[model samples]
Target: MAKEKFKDAEKGNAVEKEAEDLENGNANADAAVPAPLYPKMAEDPRARWAFIRKVYTILASQFLFTSAVGAVGAFVHPIPKFFLSGGLTSIVVFVAILLSPFIAMFPMLIFRRKHPINLVLLAIFTACISCSVCILSSFFGVKAFLEAAILTCTVFIALTLFTFWAARGGNDFTFIFPFLFATIHVLLVYLIIQLFFPLDRIVYTVYSLLATLLFSGFIIFHTESLIKRHGYDEYIIAAIDLYLAGVNLFTSLLGLAGIA
Candidate 1:
C-alpha cells in the first residue's frame, strides 16, 4: 500500500508539470502575435460598406457644391470677365493660383480633428478651387464645359467599377505607385517648362491627354486605397483624395477638348 501511494503521488506531480508547461506554451504563442493596425473591414462587410458610403457621399456633396460655384462664376458677367481679363498676366488670378493650394491645405491640417471647423474650412477650400475652375471654364465656353463634365462623369463611373472588380478578384494596386510617382514628376517638369515657354495648341492637347490618363489612374489608386488600406476612421482624407482626383480629371478633359 505504501509503494502504491508513492507511485500515485509521482504520477500527480508529472501531470501537474505537463499542465503548467502547456499553459506557458500558450502564453508565449499569444505574445508572439502583434495586434492589427487597422479595423478588420475585410471581415465585416457592413462596416466596410458603411465606410465606403460615407466617403462617396462626401465626395458627391463636394462635387455638387463645386459645380454650383463654377456655374455662378461662369455666368456672372463681372466674375468671368474679372478672372479672364489678364489671363496669366493678371496679378489677382496669379496670386490666387499661387495661394490656393496653401489655402486648401491649411484647412485640411487645422480642422483635421472632425469638427464644425472642418466643415467651414472645407467650404473655403472648395470655394477657392471652384473659382479657379470657373476661370478655366469661362475660357472654354458653355459647350466645352458641358462636354467635359459628361466625359468626366463617364470616366469616373467606369474607373470606379473597374476598381471594385479588381479588388474583388484579390488584386491590389501596390505595384503602380512607383510608376505613378515617376510619371507625376515628369508631368510637373513639363508644366514648369510650359510656364517659361508657352506650348502650342498641339503640345497642350497632348499634355491634356496625358494628364487625363494619369488622373484616371489616380482615381483607381485612390479608390482602392480607400477600400483596402485605409481605416474606417479616415473618411475625411479619403474624400479629399477622391475629390481632387475627380477635379483634376475634369480639368484635364476640359483641356483635351480645347476649351481651357
Candidate 2:
C-alpha cells in the first residue's frame, strides 16, 4: 500500500516537472526539446526518424526484457498452472500487474538516469514483476495468453507511434485531459470491482479499447508537454513517466485481450 502511494507520487512529480518547464521556459533545454517537444515546429526530417528509432528501440527492449522476466517467474513462482483461472491466484496476479506502474514509477522518479544501461537491472526486475502476472495468466491457455501479451505489446507500439505522429504533425492531442482523467477514474473503480467480481466480457473489451486510446493520447500529450510545452528538462523522469504510461496501457490491453 505504501509502495502504491509512492508510485502515484512519482507520477504526479512527472507532470509537475513538465509544468515547470512550460512556466520557466528555460532556454538551456532548447536543444534537448527535439522537434515535437519544441515550442515551435521546425522542418527536420531526421527528427521523425530519430523519434521513431528511439521508440522502436525501447519497445523491442521492453518486450524482450518483460518476456524474460515472465519466464523466470514461471519457473520459480511455485504457483499452480491454474493460477489465473480464478480464485486467489487470479486476484494476486491481477492486482500485482495492475499496480505495476505505481510500483515502478515511485523509485524511477527519485533518481532518474539517462543511459538505459544505467537502469537496465531495475527495468528488468520491474518488467519481471509485471510480466509475471501476464505469464501466469497465460498458463490457462497458450493461445489466449499470447493474444493477451501481443495485444498489450500492440498498445505500447501504438502509443509510441502516436507520440511520433503528434510530434511530426500539428494535431495537438494535448487537449484530452478532462476526458482522460474521467476515464481513468472510472477505469480504476471498474478495475477494483473486477478484482472481486466477474465483470462482463463486453465491459472488459470496451475498457481495453479505452485504455489504448487513453494511453496513446497520453504519449502525445506528455511528449509534447515535456519538450515543447511542459518543462521536464529532467528527461530522465519524463521518460520514466512515459514508459509507465506505455507499460500500464499494455497491461490493461492484455487483460481485455486475454478474455477476448
Candidate 3:
C-alpha cells in the first residue's frame, strides 16, 4: 500500500512539471513574434520626390518669367516719352515705387498659402521697373537715361556681389538689418521734408544714392530668402516680386542719378 501511494504522488508531480513546461514554451513563443509594421503610418517614399519635382518646375517658371519681363522693358524703351514736369514724374514714380512691395507680394496674398506666385510677381515687378526707367530716360534725355542706367546697374550689381560675398565668405548679415532699416527710414523722412521744400535739388540726388543702397540690400535679402526658406511653391510669385524690386530699384536709381 505504501509503495502504491508513493507511486501515485510521483505521477502527480510529474504531470504538474510537464504542464509548467508547456506553459513556459507557449510564453516564449508568444514573446518571439513581432508586431506588423503598418505602411500607412509612415510617409511615402514617392512624396519627397514629387515635392522635389514641383519645386524644380516652380524655379524654372521664375527664370522664364524674368526673361519675359526684361524683353518687355527693352521693347518699350523706344516709345515716345509720356509725361513731363518734375512734379508729375515724381508722382508717377512715387506711386509705382510705393506700390512695388505690395505688387510683389500680390501672389502671396492670393494663394492663402505659400506658393510660387511670389516668384513670378517678383519677375514682373522687375520688368515694370526696367520699363519705368526706360520711359523716364526716354523723356529725361538720352544722355541722362544712359548715365542713370549705368549708375543704377553698377550699384545694383555691386550690392548683389557684395552681399553674396558676405553671405558665403562668413559674415552673418542678418544682424545688419536693423541698421539698414533705420537708415532707410531716416532717409525717407528727409525725402518727405525735401518734397515739401522743393528748394533743394541736391536732396533728390542724396535720396537716389540712399535708395540704391537700400534696394541693393533688398535684392540680397530677397534672394537669400529665396534660396533658404521660400521653397518651390513660392518660386513663381517670389521671382516676379524680386524681379520687379530689382528692375524698379535699378531704374529709380538711374532716374535719380540722371534727372536734374
Candidate 4:
C-alpha cells in the first residue's frame, strides 16, 4: 500500500511540474513576440492626425522646393535654353527621369531605418523632378506658369477635402485600383502615339483635360489611402505618391493652358 502511495505521489509531482513548464514556455513565447513597427493609424486618432500632418508638411516643403527650382530655371535665361537645346540640361533631365524610380526606391530598400538618408534621397528625387518642371515651365512663360500653379493647387485642395469627406463616410477606394491601372496604360500608349504622330490641337486639349482629371482622381485615391489604408510608418511613400499626383496635375494644367 505504501509503495502504491509513493508511486501516485511521484506521478502527481511530475504532472504539476509538467504544467508549470508549459506555463513558462507559453510566457516565454508571448514575451518573444515583437510589436509591429507599422501599426494601423486608423485605430488611433492622435496618431493618424500626426501622420497626416507630417505627410502634408513634407509634401508642402517639396512643392516649395520644386517651385523655387522651377522659378530659378525659368528666369535664368541660359538655364532653360541649355536644357531645351538638347545640351547638358537635356541630358541631365533625361538621366534623372530615367533613374528617378531607382533613386526613390533606394532609400526604401536599404536606408528605410535611417531618416537622414531617406530625406536626402527624397530631396534629390524632388530636385530632379523640379529641374524637369523648370524646363517645361520655361516654355509656358511666367503668367501661364502662375495660372497653372494656382489651378493645380485649387483642384488638389478640393480633391483632398473630398477624400477626407469620403473617408469620414467610410468609403473604400480600393475598387479604383484596377481602373487606374488600365487608364495609366492607355495614357502611356497615347503618349507614345504623340511622340510618333503629332496630335492636333483639339486632341492635345482633350488629352490634357483627361490627364488632369485622371490625376485628380489619383490625388483623391492617394489621399484616402494615406488616411485609411496605409500604416502610420508609411509617411515617405505617402508623400511621394501625393507629390507625383500634384506634379502630374500641374503639368496637365500647363498643357491644357496651351503653354506646353
Say which candidate scores most in TM-score.
1
Off by over 4 Å in 1: 1-41, 87-90
Q: Candidate 1, residues 1-260: lDDT per residue as tens digits?
A: 99999999999999999999999999998776543223443345556777889889888988898787666655566765665577665766658764796678776766665776776777677777877787777777677778888898899999999988777777788788788778889899999999999999988888888889888989999999987877877777788888888999999988877535
Query: What's the true lDDT of residue 138 in model 1?
Result: 72
Q: For this target, which candidate reaches the highest lDDT against the unseen true structure?
A: 4
Root-mean-square deviation per candidate: 9.3, 19.1, 14.5, 10.5
lDDT, candidate 4, 1-260, per-residue tens = 99999999999999999999999999998776543223332265656778989999999999999888777755667765766688776787667764775666666546544687777878887877887788778877777788888998899999998878777766677788788878878888999999999899988888888888788889988998887777777788899899999999998998877534
Tens digit of per-residue lDDT, candidate 2, span 1-260: 99999999999999999988876776655655554443365545355445545544554566566665554544544444445468886788667765775666656655555465436644744574556554554443445446656765666566656765666565666668888788889888888998899678788788778877777667666665544443323444445556656666656665665566
TM-score of 4: 0.76
So what's the TM-score on candidate 2? 0.59
What's the ranking of the predictions by TM-score, best on top? 1, 4, 2, 3
- Ranked candidates, highest lDDT first: 4, 1, 2, 3
Flag regions of model 2 displaced more than 4 Å: 1-59, 71-104, 113-125, 131-136, 152-155, 226-233
Q: What number of clashing residue pairs does each candidate have, in the order they appear?
A: 0, 4, 31, 0
What C-alpha lDDT do the candidate models reach, one value each? 0.79, 0.61, 0.56, 0.81
Comparing 3 with 4 on TM-score, the higher-scoring candidate is 4
Model 3 lDDT tens row, 28-55: 9867653212223133324433543454
Worst 10-residue lDDT window, candidate 2: 226-235
**In candidate 3, how many clashes are counted?**
31
